[model samples]
Structures are given as structure tokens and as C-alpha cells.
Target: MKIPVIGRRDDTADTPDHPATDPIEELRAQLRRVCGGRLRTLDAEREHLDARRRGEAARMRRVGE
Candidate 1:
């Protein structure tokens, strides 16, 4: 004997009080939050390295002259 195939009901599902979020979007938001500080630190380091390289290049040019 075959039983009735009841369709899924969203209302029946146990959802939290907040709205549901897409998994991918949730992960992207998490990455943005976690990596934001690291990205800022990396940017500061890059600027420092660039300034050091420029200073070295200027020193070399003066030495050559």
C-alpha cells in the first residue's frame, strides 16, 4: 500500500526568529568580518615596504652619482 506523499511546508520547519540567510552569503559575510582587520594590517605593511623600497632606490641613485 502506497502512502500519501505530503509536500514540504516551510511553516512547519523550525526556523529561528531571524530571517534565513543563504549559506554562501553567510560565509562571505563571515570572511569579510574576520579578514577585515588582517587586510588593513597587510595594507599598512605594503605601504611601509613601498616606502622602504623607494628610499633604497633613491640612496642607490645618489651613490651612483
Candidate 2:
């Protein structure tokens, strides 16, 4: 028999005061947390690449001059 794993505390029947927690909501929260870090890292990478591109362009111009 496969046991169902409930990811959120609100999914429990005992928590009447809380709205029923959706498994997808728990997943979305985790996804957002994980992707947030990835986004920051990508942003930093983009900035670095842009700066490198600019530096390369400047160097080429200097060489041409």
C-alpha cells in the first residue's frame, strides 16, 4: 500500500481554524524559494557577462586606435 505524504500542517483534520493546505501550495512555496536563489544567481551572471562584454569592446577599440 502506498502511503500518502501530506506536505503541509493545515492538511491535517485537527487544524479546523486553518484553511486546508494544498499540496501544490507547499510545492509552489518550495519552488519559489529554490527558484529565487537561481534567479539571483542568473542576474549576477548576466551582470558579469555584460561587464565583460563591455570590457572586451573597449579593449578592441583601444587595439584599433
Candidate 3:
């Protein structure tokens, strides 16, 4: 004798009318947006510091000569 299971549905099934969105992908996209902004800010700050360092080096070289 076979017994049918009730209140059970397949979560991975997708229909043509509506597509299922993966929660993992959504979280990854949000993380990328946040990390991308932080990376850009850090890059700008590094460039500014490098420029200042170069200016100081040039001044030291002129003083030594």
C-alpha cells in the first residue's frame, strides 16, 4: 500500500510565467554593491596619499641638492 504525502511542495520547481530568484544570488549582489563602493573610496584615498608622498620626496631632493 502506497501512502500520499500532504503539505509538501517542491521549492526548486520553476514555471514559465514566473521565475524563481535565488536568495544567495540576491545577497551576493547586495554585497558587491557595498564592497564596490568601499573599494572605490579606498582607492581614491590611496591615490591622494601617493601624490602627497611624491611631493614630499621632490621637496627633500631639492633641499639635498
Leading candidate by lDDT: 2
Model 3 compared with the native: what TM-score? 0.39
Q: Each model's TM-score, in the order given?
A: 0.39, 0.40, 0.39
lDDT of 1 by residue, 1-65 (tens): 22212332345234674345555555555566678834335788799899999999999999999
lDDT of each: 0.61, 0.65, 0.60
| Candidate 2 lDDT (Cα, 0 to 1) | 0.65
Clash list (residue pairs), candidate 2: none
Local error of candidate 2 at residue 5 (angstroms): 18
User: Which of the predicted structures, 2 or 3, would earn the higher TM-score when compared with the native?
Assistant: 2
Q: Write the per-residue lDDT of candidate 2 for residues 4-56, one digit (tens) a residue.
A: 25563524435665455578765665566768834335789899899999999
The C-alpha local distance difference test score for the whole of candidate 3 amounts to 0.60
Instruction: State the number of backbone clashes in model 2.
Output: 0
